[model samples]
Target chain A: DAGITQSPRHKVTETGTPVTLRCHQTENHRYMYWYRQDPGHGLRLIHYSYGVKDTDKGEVSDGYSVSRSKTEDFLLTLESATSSQTSVYFCAISDPGLAGGETQYFGPGTRLLVL
Target chain B: EDQVTQSPEALRLQEGESSSLNCSYTVSGLRGLFWYRQDPGKGPEFLFTLYSAGEEKEKERLKATLTKKESFLHITAPKPEDSATYLCAVGEGGGGNKLTFGTGTQLKVEL
Candidate 1:
């Protein structure tokens, strides 16, 4: 739960359009991540932010970019939407300083559809 | 590169039936192994994080055990509510924060 929420719970856009998904966390955790889940591919990280204004790419960051200007917010942007990019996106915050470190708490997810 | 594989792709269990889901992983270094439960149309919910071999964690009717090469999520007496996709992921600590995940095991429990 981690007090996380993602905006635009469901969206449909045409190919080549730019899309952005927002991930907000109230836990104020230092680490936040964006991941996409698809059939056969499970979940693949798109990007992550270790601190405000510090972002890094993940395994499948080719078509996506991210920004984190504040501690509680991380945004993932798809430069150009493609049918192949259509998938369920999830937001997660790492529970650092806890007994179970590196364990991520995920949001409800946003379903994006590209036509 | 690290790799994860979950077996039985899908499983069907009746109420009160007990079973186990397997997650096999190969990483350069094992930092933490995590288990998650995801329902349809929702993101994965964290369940357990095992740090080393022989370590185990439990929550109600679910128990997770980790070994050198694999982890097992055991269900002691599942109910219809227990039906969901179980996910396994592993981290190679100190290298990066990305956790490689398996495709997951879809479980269906019927009454």
Candidate 2:
């Protein structure tokens, strides 16, 4: 309920197809992150953006890409989806800082299924 | 490598039962520790944030305490609505805005 919304809350697609997910935030936070949640892996960061057009790769950035063209919109793209990428994706926003001021607010999440 | 481990992968408690979940972490420099609750098919919701060792915070029937190497999330007289996956994360010191999270402890409260 942090004014964050993810589009296509659920999706099912075949392998080798391209997929893109969108995360939009109304709060206009400075930091944005994309993460994937798996059963045993917890939540792994996929990519993060510090500002519009400024992005960095995370621990598991393989086969995935992200773009932040504006302050409120961040997009995650899968060049060629695979069954291994089937998981719940979450988007988070936070103010620019560390320690106590860096608490992240998460969106509802997108469940992706690849066959 | 920064690591966080949560104990008791799953816990079942009767309504009004009090219990605690543990989160142990190892990081270069501990900037802050966070507690989150995530329901099934939903994103994690922030519950508490502890800035340093010996720090504590509470909300409703939940309390979070932080130590140098570990943190505890104590639930008092839990209700059925308290059932969810509790996640703990550590934010490293300096300007690293990244967070390392634990696998989380799933708690189920029944009447």
Tens digit of lDDT per residue, candidate 2, span B34-110?
A: 89999998899999988889889999999999998999999999999999999999887766388889999999999
Q: List the residue pairs that clash in candidate 1.
A: none
lDDT of 2 by residue, A1-115 (tens): 7899998899999999999999999987889999999999999999999999999998899999999999999999999999999999999998845445678889999999999
User: Which segments of candidate 1 are over 4 A away from where they belong?
Assistant: none
* TM-score to native of every candidate shown: 0.97, 0.97
Task: Write out the backbone clash pairs for model 2.
Answer: none
* Model 2 / residue A8 / CA error / Å: 1.2
User: On a 0 to 1 DockQ scale, where is model 1?
Assistant: 0.82
* DockQ winner: 1
| Model 1 TM-score, 2 decimals | 0.97
Q: C-alpha displacement of A27 in model 2, angstroms?
A: 1.1
On a 0 to 100 scale, what is the lDDT of residue A3 in model 2?
92
The global Cα lDDT (0 to 1) of model 2 is: 0.93
Compute the lDDT of residue B74 as modeled in candidate 2.
Answer: 97
lDDT of 1 by residue, A1-115 (tens): 5799999899999999999999999878989999999999999998989889988889999999999999999999998999999999999998565667588889999999999
